[model samples]
Target: MTVLALEPQPLAFRVRPQADECFDSWIDRVAAAHETTRPALFRHLGLEAAIASLDLARGTCGLSNEQYFAVYQVIGQLAWAVEIEVQQIEGTFLNVEASVVLPRRQRRYVCPLCWQQALRDGRAPIIRKEWILRMSWRCQVHALPLCALPVADGAMSEQAVGSWLSGAVARAESLRWKLGAHPRLVEWNAEGVDTLVRASRKRFKGEKKAYVDRFQANLFHFAHDRIAMLALAHSRVGKATWGFERLVALELPGRPGREVMTLQPPKLPPRRWRISKGSLRPGSHDAGVLDLVLAYAHLRVRRDA
Candidate 1:
């Protein structure tokens, strides 16, 4: 007697991706609906190998050509298994060019208020794609500073995410002011951060490179002036306030066209200013630092005019 083989069936509980949701966020929700971990879900769907090959830790942004091909192939399989349109799955991935202007986040950050809203709405909280961008310091909707939580190194299970959200929300409630951006930082964000980000998104290679170079030059000058001001202000206070001393030493100074290194406390010895052989290069600086510099530069230019 011969036996017939049956094809794998689609998932019974297909959770759709939420708006502006990252790929991992969508997968976590799907895994929770099925009451399984992400790895187990992928394995059961026969996509363990394909999923493993993709470097999804930092997310779908800045994928190489080969990685893009892998994504297309894997998403096809993923969509079929989930019984969703391939476009729906593909929409979760960000196809932005990797640039220093918008660097990938080292760890996840979320808005506590947003998470609470999602819970109240009877849905799993999602990690927004915007929050993963290192430059995104505040929630556009709530106007609250995004809270940084120490997440597990890689993709997390739904239960783990829930635990993290709970802790983050509690922490946010307790230390709301502490987590907020400095008043100056807030002013900078309001002035020029968004404009700089929009300009950085130019598509053509030549145009993008030119714009980035100009941006970096402005950033270097801004950092130079801002660090000096921070150092002077902290020294007069006889101590650092709001981590300004650290901000004086923050990586921004070293990145500017002229390399400026500040001593700890920024008051002990004179700052050692040196000129680097080269100016700012693309994809070589932190997004947070760039955002700070951009804000100062924009405000400074406006004031000068």
Candidate 2:
């Protein structure tokens, strides 16, 4: 007997996001570009099954693998006129977050300079991946505090958010204090540190690695074993990996960034120096501090080449 084959399904929306963009922002822009609402798009993508389990409009992990492809196919067919590669648009950014749920940021953040540039280029504002990580707060590129996007009640149209975007950029630019922008953030990412840590952890053989999730192994050594911290921090041509064992031996300190790198702002816009000094308290040593450490960690990752 001959068997009948089923046809692959298509998604409702036809648009895709630009590079380094987040799924949340991509969906909203797609809705706006298509002159439709997200709820309407959701209904079209057969995403109802995953909707209750996720905040489909605001989250990156909203849809399952199955649903993601259904939506991807639809958007691909619609946006075929554009030059984007579908794989890079979705499910392509690798991270540890997929297996673990991370707490949400208390406030929204956007880069004013980035928004201005994206608009100039005729592209939607790209939502960066690092901003979703709790460890990120400042925009390294503009050396500015990421301004907040006021949260609206559910289903606010994309047009409303677009208007809010312009206001948020103006507000972020007028801010009293912000960090000096890193000149080469185009080449920086936290994932590079993740790769380094993964390589370093191989030295442990059978040791527990949960702490590696935060690059805590190096910090653990820096805090509890100053001697090893001293050694590892003084990276050499080929001996850094040898110090990994000694590094993880120690308990952590109250502040690891201070131990790793006494990070300082690069260059402040004139008249904002006073505010920048107060806003960035080195002693508080929070995620912003972690950002420095992670960036420094990536610098080391590049040395492998």
Candidate 3:
């Protein structure tokens, strides 16, 4: 059938089975879907592992009690360590290693002046047109950023430096994952609790901006949305709580945020639900719900085609 003709059909057949789905399975699926996106730090599985690991560590570390966000901060440190190592390796080898191996791949270096100039001008020089660094870090030349960096001292070709740096970053990330210093609350004592609380509180506060900076950062990683959902699921309209609305307000980007929608209660007449699908981009099911809600509530606006 033609694509346009199938627009209104229910997608019951395409819904993947959620039965017995483990956390690892979900992680794998998420990683596979977003591996190609920009901002390497955000897409890296190490970040997730760091959070999950830290959470697991909190209870064992002998802290006063388990604070989910506290553990999340520890994971961020691991991610930062990986990033720093990668940048350091890239800068260090750009001048000496004309060619290098990064993990399973081989790379060559490029010119130093070219890269430096590009960096200075904030524009990435087009050496064969492939980006050499993260787009965000590229140099701006002619009002646009350049995507490649020249090797330091011209000792190695650009490609080689890039590969070497990539390899270094990968190795560091792997090592960080294996280090595992997370301890649980049960493992700590009164003194340990004081120390752990101070340390963890600082860590949590430090990451406040990062937590609220992006939708996915807050939703998937922060776990605030899920907690909020549970609260809203059980709350009634007049029984509003302090954090109840805030939870509902923090919707994932590109989906409705803070907007009221029909929330179907499990055992009663469907109540309005204000939910943002957050990174779970809408498909056929979403469209149907929108249609049903807007039609029933008289909120659907017709437009001229």
The TM-score values for the models, in the order shown, are 0.54, 0.44, 0.15
**True-structure lDDT of candidate 2:** 0.44
Q: Which candidate number maximizes TM-score?
A: 1
The order of the candidates by lDDT, greatest first, is 1, 2, 3
Which predicted model would earn the best lDDT?
1
Q: Give the TM-score of candidate 2.
A: 0.44
Per-residue lDDT of model 3, residues 193-280, tens digit only: 2232233333222333332222111121122222222122222321222133344445546775443354321233444543222232
For model 1, residues 49-90, the per-residue Cα lDDT tens digits are: 556545463445567787766666767777887778987776
Better of 1 and 2 by TM-score: 1
- Angstrom error at residue 147, model 3: 3.6
Candidate 1's TM-score reads 0.54
Residue-by-residue lDDT tens digits, candidate 2, 105-164 = 322456767877877788767666544433344465765545545666655555776676
Q: Which residue segments of model 2 deviate by more than 4 Å?
A: 1-14, 46-86, 91-94, 98-107, 153-305
